[model samples]
Target chain A: MHDARYGWSSVHRCPSRHSDGERPRPARPGGGLTVPTIETRGLTKSFGDVDAVLDLDLTIEAGEVFGFLGPNGAGKSTTINLLLDYIRPTSGSVEVFGMDAQRHPAKIRERVGVLPEGYGFDDPLTGREYLDWAIGTKDADDDPAALLDLVSLTDDAGRMAADYSKGMQQRLAFAMALVDDPDLLILDEPSTGLDPNGVRTMRENVADVAADGTTVFFSSHHLAEVEAVCDRVGVMNEGELVAVDSIDGLRDTVGGHAAIELECATPPTELGVEALDGVVDVAVEDHTLTVTCVDPGRKIDVVTHVAERADVVDILSTTVSLETLFNELTEGGREGGGETTAEVAQ
Target chain B: MSIDSVLSKDLTSVRRSGALWGVAVCLTMLATMVAYVNIGRGAPPLREAQDAYGLLAGLVGVLVPIVAIVASYMSITGERASGGIKFLLAFPNTRRDVFAGKLLSRLAVVGVIVLFMFVAATAITVAKYGVLPVGVAVGVFAVSLVYAWAFVALSVAFSSATASRSQAIAAAVGSYFLLVILNLTFRFSQVVRLVYDTILGLGENPHLYAAADYVSPYIAYQKAANLVYPAAMERQVFRLPEEARETLPVYLTDEFSLVVFAAWLVVPLALGYLRFQRSDLQ
Candidate 1:
């Protein structure tokens, strides 16, 4: 919403692209909290024959950590580029902080801090110079040392970026995005080129930034990070928004079945097993009883049934990981096995 | 578009780059060495300030083009190749701002190099000949800046137009051959005449070499210099005045050299900016 202290974003106050007879004033300017940090309706982009991103609608709230996930060729980068107005959309509209992205790219960019994927740093700029340059571009007052400190690169801020390692460069990029104390942070593949420790630091930095009332909209193919950081995750497949929900909600989509694997003493019959409460599917294989149970309340009854009927040595309740849910929901080539790496790598 | 922001960023990056500084230092040394040999050496040395000025003019006319090619051949292409332009455009700049900023900053760079060489040339000529010939020094410096501007424009155009640094290099080198070498070398002039007279249906013209020279920006610079200070520079610059040059048309006159320089400055930048603005950087 609106803060008179920040003023109305007068720069992006142009008439919306599809202005009819009368203009509808946006609510964010009226001090209402309904305006999303990023919103897209029927957004589409196509490069020749390939529809990189199709009619997609998305809404990300303020102070929300929205994880945009997709398999390769799922138009994740295309969507990010569209949101940033790097390329013209084939059709539809995008808005960031109640301003149309296409109509007010510069104004949108002023308040939005972005770490675009597939971008490189100036070789001669020291880490400090890079941060200062970003500050200059945003026309915002920022201390280079504090920005570098946030990324844990304060000691190496004086060193040329050419000498910095890949992870260091990514950290520097993250720091540069914080120059203006932006209202929104769009980090595309922020954890890429990082070691395990670097990934942890990135996650912490993201968390710390989000805690300052800045909405963080990040795209990642890495499942666990999204699950850890995102309040909601959107999955795209074949140029379309295929899934959008919380991590657990997505895992619960196909009946929220809880998978329980048991080490059984003997082979179990399927007749009584299928009749058990909340059990959607059951299969016995190689001395293990696997039960897909939908209800957590009936989980104990299934264990009782198994233990009473066929000696259950051990029972394990495994929650479906976001990785598995992602693979199952998106086009991971399970049903069609002939998909090549080119199709997968898009 | 934030032109000031982009220009500052560009200048900051260029100043810190060792390669650019190295180019500047190397070009300065080369200009000074060449100036030293041209005016100070030989039995009956060309000691007149205007004469030494003409010789120094030739020295820098050749030198500035080389430096321009070297300094800007990869100006935009290298950044695009390394995916750095994406980073630049990720800020508040439009693509046009990036192009304008690059042009202004790089022109400033080449301008500094030309200034250094001209200052040193003016100093050495004044020291050796006991006169500054203030008018000639100013004319030559102004002409040299324009000369460097044309080359920088062409180089930056190629840099923005090409997809790769290697292609930019090839374009810069090829442009160097077309504009800098075609008229100076007889063979290149002969080859051009052959292509025009024998290959094309244009009737045999003995003035084809002069026609080629009129189109070349470097030749225009020399012509402009001669037109400005013809009496003093006649014995200064080494050139065989051909009949074709005397009969060269009104449009190809020394005044049109400014026109040529202006086209070289504007056309390439316009085309390059349009392409850079429209193209998908990634």
Candidate 2:
């Protein structure tokens, strides 16, 4: 019911109406606003001579699923560790919820839930007991039984934490993070060892929580998971965030906008739609017209005109996958220029 | 928000499934219950019960190090190994709170075990003699506990700095033995005495033994323990040679050495807490 209300409200609030009568809704006070949940400016960390994270500047918005997409040794974990105050940055500062994180890590952590990668809980306690102990320090309205049920660990809840499988342990960790119903959830490689269905459930759970206006900051090498769950993603390569934007915005930057696929019963002659605005390239494969457009909607009119001449059987659009987009953006190229690619100093 | 909550949680958690409490209790029972050769020959008298004070000191001497080492090693390493340190550190407690809470809990473990054993020892002494020397027994127990607490802090310092349980344990034990052996050798060996006399200029120095007292906390504790014994009172009555007098005051008569040993506890603990606050947990 709440979903419908939000859905309709979002649809009615047109982009132009964002100015005139509305004062941007007074920044939503504390909810649904783009306030920085975590902000790092000129953040640098070094272990001896090796720089793990170098001059990283990032802003993770409140209530947004912010994905830190990076490869191994790309400093995703290091950045998370810095934010958690497990390690002090060699330079610069980290702020969480508008407070200095290093100075008040404990207070910052109280409102944040973190599932650190490869974290192993004590073996003596059962799954339920471990979660209970983990959440004991926080204020919560959860019973271990309900939490176990949510994570689908009702049966295994009785078993010792050591006896849990890798996936089960991961699930239990997720349950532990959810115990406090935290405002900020920081997950480092959250879907590490899960099966396909488990991954789906994990993705759904993350999305569901983020949908309810909890800021989620997660790091993952799996671009598909990031694409599915994150509203905005920052790609980290060699300890620097190279790109930060919505998935669609990244795709457009990397793969040069969304393409409209037109399968016509009769192919148009002379590629007339190529001369149309926003149509970058046009290729006719048998009866299908594959139109690569800088603006998909602009080409939509041209495609419709062409379809009036040719009997159109199918009309489809293609957006670049997160993987292809990530590679192209990080690799650095000049095929299409729309948005400026952001680069962080090392 | 409260330090007691943190300390209470630590104590309860450590007591539940961990082996520290059980080991401490077992060692204390064995030390107090078993008859030692050092306190024997005469039976069923006030003097005999006073003789048991030295035996009780010996019991504490053997048991305190073991408990100190076990509890200290378990304090930080156990939490880190279980990944509970992250959970604990993430709460609304500062590094000072965490360090102090763990230190107090470990000390409390030793205190509880030693107190139980002291009560048992007093009961045994009462059964053998007509009455218990409640004052001496309780004072000795309290003094020994303070001394044990010094080592407990040292062990925790090592535990916080080291990466693994084995490493922490090994470091604690190695340091413990090194101090004891070095102090013992410095006291007995003529070559060492000659070296100290030549290099550190202690040949005719009156304060040579007093300066040497810095090597081990055990010496200070042992001196205090002897003072609580009735034999020590007898020693105080007899006339002694000049060297004996100087050595006796340094080891057995000075109250200031215990204060210095007590400082060792606080300094290492502060260093450990600082390191823990900044050190990466990876």
Candidate 3:
């Protein structure tokens, strides 16, 4: 029943490896079959006249780190809120561990750990106290010190969370989300206020948990981090999920191309590379000939054509980054273009 | 377990808040002043102690509701406004746990002030009069506790139903004026009687008028307080004729005031929870 446009069939589920023997596996609500860690069908939410999330259909298998990539106001947080049932869907359903999220939120939450966006800490509660509260609420036996160490907040654990800096609070919150060794972790814009070091720690923490068989659903607008850790990403734009694919698949879906900056002995005169098949654009500046192609395979063809026209000296090639793909899918691909590759792939 | 966790966490947070301490100190000072003034009126020690209890009831009946409102009106909405509730609900605790925890924690906060007020009053009365109306003091304490809880419930109900701090504040302040201040001035009962009489054409019905008067939690508290310290009966806004007082309708009796107090405690909270359970925290 999965939508082929989301590329769910190609989603690779890492082998289950329960590294922490001390943490008990949460019992799935419906016992016989392997259930998708999270599944939302036709999920939609509206705030009065505006719909914050629209017609979202997604499925994340166990042990997969699925990135929810979207720009600001792309309804990423809204979808997470719907998954946690913090906000009810306007006219759809979400399931976590094969149980209806709305009907059994507390039960579903028993196995889920969430780092919600714009979360504020209670006054005068030390970082340790916040961790203790999370542990107690989940009835988990995690050592607070270890969690603090994980987030590099060991020294700041004794300080009041209200006194913590944005980055410190983000780290503290990440530690709290790691409590009880949750079966599913949903982090929304987790790296928003973190420094480079803090961002690396978050990525490693996500990877560490995913290795222990936790299903991680991380949402972010930061492409590099999502590209670094996510097994697959679903791009959202203006409340609609525009694309979902593996990093390589996304590159391919967007007609993955490379920009070749050829440093020639002499600038090509009357170069007809633009007329070649798959050649998107060509320009010459000083002693350099730049060729943009719609396919990576066209790189060699352009170089060969250039060598015939003029003496070829050196070549540098850069492949399409996720940023370009994101802009293409969310920006130009949505407004004027009638259908994007993501739509056609369906 | 989740409820306990939420309650204890909230208690720790509320305990450190300066506002709760401010309310407590003010309440204690007021109780002590009322006790000192009433007991110093110079009468037989027994009569003076009883008189002190009556005066203390008047002081608590007005101040306890205000204290409860201030203590609880922002309990939920403040968290929601500051985004603290997202952290609170991030764990496995259900919305029910959050609501019940807030209710109980605010009750505990107000309960401490109510307990301190009675203790101070009792100490002052015992010191000055060398005698104590133990039965009346205990009964008034019980009734005042319920009165505080009733108002706390109402304020928390406002907190839960409102999506913003300003809306909750408006509801709280408006309620205080309508239920306590206006009720004290008999304006609320007068309006109730006007509507009741005009609607049902029950002209000159003293029982109906008395029943309408008891609708306010403030008046219900006085009736309940009067049951313990009969001196409070003189403060009643809608006094029936002597003959009718002896044959009062059930709804107009002191016992029925307890029912009103119970309704005040329950109905608002139920409505609040209904709204809270369905609301999107964002």
Candidate 4:
């Protein structure tokens, strides 16, 4: 399990593992079989009359980069806190590495690295000192200078962490989370205070770690970031897991199609494009033929059929982006009308 | 190992706090000046040195609790308020480790200050009296250290039980007023007398007033310090009437005051840990 050779390829052998819900365990580099990195069953947490997280059942496989997407106050941080056993669940159970999270918190945390949300460094210790203490507590021999270099904070290692800017503190926290080569890296809002460059670097670092067989579970509301790196993303709204699927899977589930606009020399009149497979709609206006397809791959077929009928001049195509799908999912749930959202999830 | 890491880190962070240093400097000066003034008045007899030690003990009994409360009242609640406890617990450390480490580190700080005060006082005594009473000095140091620990434990207990810094500060300050200030000014005993004689109509009961006075930690410290240096009780903060002192019960003895100190040290810590362990830390 500690060997680096059990990379992403081994886990990708079963791409449909998450969908099926009960697949065989993956074999690690040392011939050891390991369970999912995280699993929650009927997990619920409530504060008085409000339910922060309600009946959440999530499973993140090893070597998979799972993105937890939700708006502010949508229970993303509460879910992460439950997984870390920072708070008790009102009902239900959470297991990490096949062990009960509440009962074996220390043992689970020994293998997990976390960048908790809203964390602060009020101590007078420098950035380097904070990293050193983290490494020592984990009983791992991580070089503080190397970790600082990874976050591009080596120059500021001597400065007090409490005095650092918000962005710099976020970077330092990310570096600290990278210590001990953790089996599971849980980042709650890791991109909260990052600039464009820092965000790019963070995305790359996440990709790099997941490639090396580290199960990366990160929570963020940034759709583009989730679309960039996650194998599967879970959408949460109002303490409920509204949807969980790959970006393409979500697009397909929402029945969002691609519209290919063909700017022909003249509009096609009777191309018989309506009869083509996967074509949802076809319209013509002012020398442009717009063909909408449920499956984007049918764009080639639509264009071929249109070329036979008219002189094609240009082609412009647009697929449904994750942003549209995310808005559709979360907005439906947020409007207090969860019926439409539940149908889409199903 | 986790506890050790937390202990060392807290020690490093708390030692740099200006409040602790300010209290330390004041305590050292108080100890030195008390010794210098009393002994420099000429060696009339051996009783002079004992009187100086008694006065120093009285002053320390008052100051040590202040230092301890200041050093520890924010040990847990401050971190919770600033969100620093999240960072500390993000590693593999358990809640037990965090509680134990914070208690021990703050106690260690107060212990060092109490030791320094005694050492400076001992230095002055040797310089003026031409001889050192090592047994008395060590006994006073031991009793003062325990006294300091009791207050530190109580303050840390408050810090652990409270979720906010303001709440912890209120509890610590309230305890100091009730335990140290009221007891020192004899107001606590007066209230007890009023409740027993006036409110309850039980007539004058000096024994109950004496017991009420000793409930305060500083008064218990004086009673315990009397065990080491008998003359220390001659200048008691609240002197019982002659009739009451003649037939003192077991609970009023100097040794029983050690039991009061022990209760102060243990009960609050246990209760605080119970509350902290069950809290959500949201």
Candidate 5:
């Protein structure tokens, strides 16, 4: 059931006739409510002489799986801190669910489940006891066992948290963050210390939660995980937001020019692929012709020329992967017009 | 929302701590031995009561402050150092809520320990002596609790004032010595007064010791206890040389002592609350 208490209406997703003989109509997304889940403008924070976050303008839409990507000391944690109001920004503004984050932190937090970085458990508490305490504070209806089951910690629910392994601790904390059925989940490195299987499970759980109209703002250094899950990625480096784009869009923008590989029946005489237009770094090996095309429109011309000499057995096109794009974007992002590349996805 | 969950979690953790229980037990045994010394040695009796009760009051003055210090010295800083305060702040809680909740938790821990020990001592004294100075015993216990609260507030204040748990511990222990040996501050204050007089050509200052009395919560606790049961206190103190004690400071009255105790209770906690709310919790 969609509860109106969560900023939704009873008429959500249903066609209904209005008063004064208005025609029947379908409900809007969230009953005409399309507020961005989170928005920031010129958000900057400085610690002493070092700026932890600088002039960051960002927006995440409702139900969007936004991945916050940055390396160590890239101000990832500091940006999360500013969003959670753990520390005030030096200048600029932040809004979560259309409410000022600094001024209405309690209200924002009430609807936002968070797994913050460097957090610790009250060690003496058993997993169940700790979750019970969390549920009490969140004022949510939850069974401790049910939450522990979600993280596959039901067997260890009675064990003291001090005795839990690092992976187990992470799972327990994740379970605790789910207690509120939050509208927005702020996860900072939630997959840290998890094994491969646990990471897969966590990815599925995040997908499940986000499917229920919840927006997830996930931060992590795990590029593979981000690539596997995020609808859009926001890259930050040295206190500056370098870029925000869909995975394919980022690949296209950052050295994702097409590469063509051709397998010919016979070695072509005077292949001279480099002499052809839009081709660079041409290499020939094992009776195969490989070249990169900065101008994709010329790929057919190159292939036609190759076919005229010898029967082309196979032809393949490939673009850069997200991992390659991530490295290049972060390594020399500023030198590559990174500022203008950041797109606000509201 | 209420911070009852934080308080309950704190209390449960405190209850399950064996080290804290060990400290409480050792203090209780020490109180028992002090009571035995009073009774077995047949120390002189105060008017209508045994001086043993006064010994208990002295024991509270000497020992309960330690319990108070131990109970809360790391309350906030410990959480901060462990990054647990972040979890609280990440929820629907403010720093002010943590402050109030932690203060209540510290009070509950110290209150249980001190009250239990005081009751056990009262029972032991009653068993040894024919009559219990139920009135004076209860009155002194009340003042001792107030004195304990003073330390609690001071401990929490210093805990909140610092970011490092180790630094909070050092400051709390240092304050314990300073509050116990409060006369050191008075003596130091006297030196300042003497230097000022010499520099300004204003000589012959006589009441410097009176000003020093405010440095020690121990002194305030004892004075408050004695004022409540003057007969027992008088019985112990009249033994001093007439001239040696005759020059006691005017501020050494029960009213002044109570005022000092109240200051200890209010000033540190008030300052801590302000500093805590003003700080940028990282």
Candidate 6:
């Protein structure tokens, strides 16, 4: 609080817009030896009368890749804006690297790199030219050619940015953000619009950057990509974070649930024989039955019994994917009686 | 972080056109020779000829604002349209730096052009007639550049606030004609009356008339190009008309116009910079 390396004078004191400012920043997991790279307490933002992000709390540690999971318009971009200080928040407080973001935005930005949701760049300049202009401000002279190689855009460095494909533009955007060699990289859907190979390259580059002690904060709708790349994941829905944990932590938090899928000759009247002791919910459509259960260990026994009772052609049981876990955590409407698709689908 | 950075960055970016300078210099020289030919056609002495030529070149004043508008119309808008403002503003420098840097560079360019015309006009007048008074010629040259600086600043400021290049150019040119013609006659009647009264006071001796006219910086810049040596400035040559002399103390005393011209540089520039700084690029 009394450090000169980062200080907040009286001019920097932000008014507490809501109860959000009072929410404690989350400490990192395990022994918490590492300092947090990004933290927020009850951070909220509203545009006109609509709330974009509401009472959100998140913490990401140094050198850890964290994925912010949310569907479009579910406040993913809004939260990024708040974190980056692109827009002022209506309530709550955001802290990046333990420094109040509003007070020290320039300093925070000096250490933080961002790839916005859109692949927005100034046209009329070649990719090489634009990178030179961007990297000029930072202290180091970054090699534009090397950056192009990292993002797999080395072959197209001389082309005007306006002519680049959406995936190629996304690659350029990532390269631009990383040009400064920032300590933290915020990538909002970095792999958006990319082919499978592009996505693989993106993941590899993100991993490479994180390996160099840069904390990678990325948001994506592809839950599997998030699970594969992120050491921790935070699930967001309806302007709020529903859960924040490691992939396995989220898997454990949503643990004991398995999806039992079966292909049948006809719609069953009742899945009595298939109703395993641990099954929580069941869905029957066409000739398929999807059973949600607390313990998948009993799924094979239940399927065998169902096969004995009905003309079941094929049956399968597998651990729930990250997509399923995300649906389970974020499903259901805000409070009360509106059942969510996750509830129905589960 | 430093003014030098802003200056160097701007200088580095702008594409200089050698052809523009070549064309501008040739045109100035041609205009000077034409004015000399008129003098050769049995026109009055160096004094009368200077006034006539000065009046013609003072017309450039009407277009000076327009030139400013055209030169600067795309300074900010071009950068904004190309998504360059964000990259530029991301630096620690303020908008003030951008405004100042751009204005200075424009003024420097205009200064060179004004100097070329002034030199050509003086050379032609000396060639047509005998040597003119050195004081009057030097004063005219200095004052013309100042006026050019003022117009350039005015145009650049308008350019910075405008959304498009065409709009900025239109506003600058339109405002120039309005201020020089309609606004002086209609909106500011008092100033026009003073100007008209001053012009009529000029007698057959066009030299005195030209000298009194130089009291108006607009007329003074023209007089400099025409090589019109005002009698008031050269007391030994002729006595200034009593009325022209009376207005002399008021009109020739340019503290007020100088301040107005200075404001042209300061106010619009400040406002333009503020607008650029706060505007959202995306």
Best-matching candidate per TM-score? 3
Score each candidate by Cα lDDT.
Answer: 0.75, 0.71, 0.83, 0.83, 0.75, 0.63
Query: Which pairs of residues collide in candidate 5?
Result: B186-B212
Encode model 4's per-residue lDDT on B144-229: one tens digit a residue: 89999999999999999898878998998999999988776656679988888999999998877888888889888988888888
DockQ score for candidate 2 = 0.28
Candidates, DockQ: 0.47, 0.28, 0.60, 0.58, 0.50, 0.11
Cα lDDT tens digits, model 3, A10-71, are 23333243223432355345643568888999999999979899999998877677999888
Which lDDT tens digits does candidate 1 get at residues A246-297? Answer: 6656757744556788888777665387676567556688888877666566
**Top-DockQ structure, candidate number:** 3
- Fnat: each model in turn: 0.58, 0.40, 0.76, 0.74, 0.65, 0.06
Ranking by lDDT: 4, 3, 5, 1, 2, 6
- Tens-place lDDT per residue, model 1, B150-193, is 99998888888887877987898898887777556653446667
Candidate 6 i-RMS (Å)?
4.5
Better model by DockQ, 1 or 2? 1
* Local lDDT at A70 for model 5: 84
Question: Tens digit of lDDT per residue, candidate 4, span A25-62?
Answer: 34544433457779999999999989999999998878
How many Å off is the CA of B17 in candidate 1? 2.7
Tens digit of per-residue lDDT, candidate 5, span A1-346: 1222222222111112122222222222565556688899999999999999999999987666788998888888998988888888899999998889878887887889888888877647888887887888888898888888889999999999868988898898889888888888989998999999999888878876765656788998777777666667899988999788866567667453566889888865567766775554466787788765665676888898888778899998776456645664566444543332332110
lDDT of 1 at B110: 87
Model 6, range B1-282, lDDT digits (tens) per residue? 434444555554443445446646665766576556653435457555555445435445654544544555666666555545444544333455556666776777677776777677777777767666465567656666676776676677776777665776687767566555543233333333445556665325433333433433343343334333465322221135565545554334333455445655577677877776444343
TM-score of 5: 0.82
Clashing pairs in 4: none
Q: Please state what fraction of the native interface contacts candidate 4 reproduces.
A: 0.74
Report the lDDT of model 6 for residue A47.
Answer: 74
Predicted complex 1: CAPRI docking category: acceptable
Model 1: per-residue Cα lDDT at residue B123 = 67
Predicted complex 2: CAPRI docking category: acceptable
Shift in Å, residue B119, candidate 2: 3.0
